[model samples]
Target: MLIDTHSHIYTEDFSEDIADVIQRAYENEVRKIVLPNIDSSSVKKMLNLTEQYPQICYPLMGLHPTSVTEDYEDELQLVEFWLQKQKFYGIGEIGIDLYWDKTFIKEQTDAFRRQIRLAVKYDLPIVVHFRESFDEVITVLKEEMQPGLTGVFHSFSGTLEQAQQVVELGFMLGVNGVVTFKNSGMDKVIEKVDPSHIILETDSPYLTPVPFRGKRNESSYLVYVAQKVAELHQISVHELARLSSNNAERLFRI
Candidate 1:
């Protein structure tokens, strides 16, 4: 079975047909979807989905970089509240994102650092989301790196050198639908990486793989990603599933 290490199917995009989405994912052998929180506003819906589909959906708690606003501390407080209240598979969907706006770069880094500390405290892996801020995110990670600090860089689209850096830092690379894009060039980078350091994800409701590009993404489409990554590594899809799923199971303890 394949594990979609990052997905937001709990979001409104799937509200109309969540059951169907989960069923499709299961049917496609894409079992165990990880739900990463965006912010306080998303916590309820995310947790609700987890509660409803406890077996297939696992939840992670964190404040996304884009969600870091002026009142981010309050949001962090809520994140801590949830972390203390219940069990979470990881601390994630958290990192620096300069692609959209850089006005809060300082705040984003601060929040990222704090959340990484939370991951360390809780003894859970992290699911990072960095976009156009690889240097910034890597800097923070290097500064905060410590024993028991581990996680995956969700939707990794970095160079082979960066991938090597992440692996050296003891983190998994989250490969998703983007690898299937005509010009993403992710396949070339992934080709040089070992399967043991890779994991599969869909980032559902976004980054849908080819043959279904331009359509709303879902966990079921993870098979396309798996197929592509398997081809890149020149391995069977079944073997790819085994390796990536084992990476996910170890990282998130799911």
Candidate 2:
């Protein structure tokens, strides 16, 4: 079964037909989807979705980097409180993103570090979102890296050397629709990284795969991403699905 490891189906983008979207996911053989909460505002919607689809949906709790602001401490407290109240598969959609704004770079770093500590505390893997700050992300991961500290760097678009660094640190590279993009450059880097170190994701409601490019994305489209991976690895789509699904299970333990 294919797993869309990082999707925000709880977002307003899917509110109109969330059930239909999820149904399509199942129909397309996307057995499970892991929801990564963006911030405090999404916590309610995220939890609600998990409750509604306990078997097929799981939630990851963490304050996203873009949500990191001056009031980050309060946000962290909320994250910690909720995480303690229930079982979440991971600590993420967390990490640094300097592409949108650099005003909170320091704060984002602090929040990311704190959340990583929380993951360490709870023995949960993390789902990182690194954009225009791969070097900084790697530096932090180096300091925080431990045998038990594992996770995937979602939507990885880095050089092969950087991909090697992430793998060396004991993390998987979360490949998404970007690999299908003609100019992504991820195709070459993914070629170098072992399939075992790669996991598939849709990052849905965004980054739609080719043919669906510039259109709304959903978990059902994961097949296209898998197809691309299969072509790149010279393996069947079923093999790619099995490998990536196994990788997801290994990292998320779901």
Candidate 3:
């Protein structure tokens, strides 16, 4: 069995047939799909999906880095409310994203630290969104480092050094469809990392793997990613699946 540690199929991308998507995920042995909330706009839909399929869908709450505007505190407050209200696998989909716009860097940093504090307080892992800002993300994480800080860098695409640093800091590297891309350069990175520090994810409705490239990604396609990572580690696909799933369970406690 496999667990898709990060996927956004709940974001209207699969609204028409999310059930079918979940079915396909289960059919492909993607037994669990973890959904991360983007902001206030996504909490209800994310919760609804988890409620609809309690056993298969798990929910995480956090403000995404891209959503870090001047009013990010409002969103963070809502995230806090949700955390206090119910159980979440982690505080996630949170981190620095200097890719799309660099204007809100300070806001994003503040939000990231606050959320990290929340994760520490809640005794939950964090799933980070470090897009085009790996150094920035790592810096903040280092500054806020404490006894129980742990999380995953979603859709991790970094060098062997960076991967080593992440694992050293007690974070698992979330590998996904990008690992299967023909020219993404993620394969070389994945090959150097130890499988014990790796976890599987699709980041679906986004980075669809090869052969299924250019198509809307879903949890079911994680197998293609699994196959690639397995090849990189010189292990069987099933073994990779078991190892990645175990890593994810340890990180998310799901």
TM-score of candidate 1 versus the correct structure, residues matched by position: 0.99
Over the full model, what C-alpha lDDT does candidate 1 score relative to the true structure? 0.94
Q: Name the candidate that leads on lDDT.
A: 1
Query: Model 1 over residues 15-84: C-alpha lDDT tens digits?
Result: 9999999999999998899999999999999989999999999999999999999999999999999999
TM-score of each: 0.99, 0.99, 0.99
**Cα lDDT, all candidates:** 0.94, 0.93, 0.92
Sliding window of 10 residues with minimal summed lDDT for model 3: 176-185
Q: Considering summed lDDT, which 10 consecutive residues are worst modelled in model 2?
A: 138-147
Candidate 2, residues 47-69, lDDT tens digits: the string is 99999999999999999999999
Candidate 3, residues 159-194: lDDT per residue as tens digits?
889999999998999998888878888999989988
Ranking by lDDT: 1, 2, 3
Error of 3 at 254 (Å): 1.1
